[model samples]
Target: MDLLDFARGPAINVAMAVLVFGVLWRLFALLFLGKPVDRTIPRLGTPGPFWAGLREIGRRMLPHPTFATAERFAFFNGWVFHVGLAIVVFGFRPHILFIKNLTGLSWPALPSGVIYAVGAITALSLIAALVKRITSPVQRFISTFDDYFTWVVTIAPVLTGLAAVGHVGARYETLLAIHILSIAVLLIWLPFGKLFHAFLVFLSRGQTGAFLARRGV
Candidate 1:
């Protein structure tokens, strides 16, 4: 039996359902339960404090012109890793096909080689980031259990994908099974962990924008 075939059937469906629900639940909770803004930070150029925070977030998201410095390299690598992982996870042909079949919506599919390359790059970048966290005193000081757990959870899918591709330590079916299982675990853990911040970030940014608008600084 094909491992990929197994993942395509009930197991994949269940995992996908859980992932969708978990993400939604966390988002809903954050939307309703998160505290209101206490104070606004002043914007550098904008008239209000809220605009400044929004601008800071935008700056953080953009790529610097050069990666000559360590900070610039880290920022670029971090963003590249996130974008690459998103493309591979959501834009791959099989994933798109599955979504089309399940939800009656279709998206453009990325090429197979590109999907694999993006996954590989994301895996490498995650590893580098984890290493930095472990070796750098500043990062280590700021790191918490959730931070390390998030790294492991985030990296597991990429590593498992590589293993499944390489047919590591077992039959392709077995490796694929492990890969699917890891994804299922990630889905369940996401809502309860720092990974939820993936969605929370946007909400936080919007809140910052709103606060700035109210202040009219």
Candidate 2:
């Protein structure tokens, strides 16, 4: 077996297995920590848990007014890379084919050149985010190993993908192998790290919103 074989086979298979198991484990852990029963009667003239929680989740997607101005850079930068990542992953023909292979789903793809350009832009956004994390005193102080580690795993695939697409730094085959391996690493680490927030953010925000909404706060 060759490098590409290893990356496309065992590495990805194990990473996906770990991803599924870890996500399920984390979710089960949260579920087991059951919410306490709410005994308080909800105040009148307010949307109940379902609507209030949904609204609050949407509301908090933006930074609070108190810090919105201060957080604008980080906020917009985050959205930039996140949206770029989505476009590259789902809009590229090869990626859509990969997803189809895994799940028997297919979608139209954007032009390869367009998706690759977006990948480059995504890489820049990630780098900008890293710089902000380092330069901002409060963010720097609050940051932990997980923060930087997650960032690396997040950016590694993007960087490697660009290299593979450009056929730079190595033979195209080798670069592609590296890119796939980086993604495998990302998948393995995602559920075990801060990256899990990709899924958890909604659960957590909705729970809080439901709790607070019951009190009409």
For residue 23, model 2's alpha carbon misses the true position, in angstroms, by 0.6
Single out the weakest 10-residue window by summed lDDT for candidate 1: 40-49
lDDT of 1 by residue, 86-171 (tens): 89889787767756787889878877888888898899999889888899999899999999988887899789878878777888
Model 2 off-target regions past 4 Å? none
- Which predicted model would earn the best TM-score? 2
The lDDT, on a scale of 0 to 1, for candidate 1 is 0.77
lDDT of 2 by residue, 1-217 (tens): 9999999999999999999999999999989987787687888788877888898899987999999998899889988999999999899888898889999999889999899899999999999999999999999999999999999999999999999989988999999999999999999999999999988998888878887887888
* lDDT (0 to 1) per candidate: 0.77, 0.92
- What clash count does candidate 1 reach? 4
Q: Which residue pairs clash in candidate 1?
A: 43-52, 47-217, 48-217, 50-212
On a 0 to 100 scale, what is the lDDT of residue 110 in model 1? 79
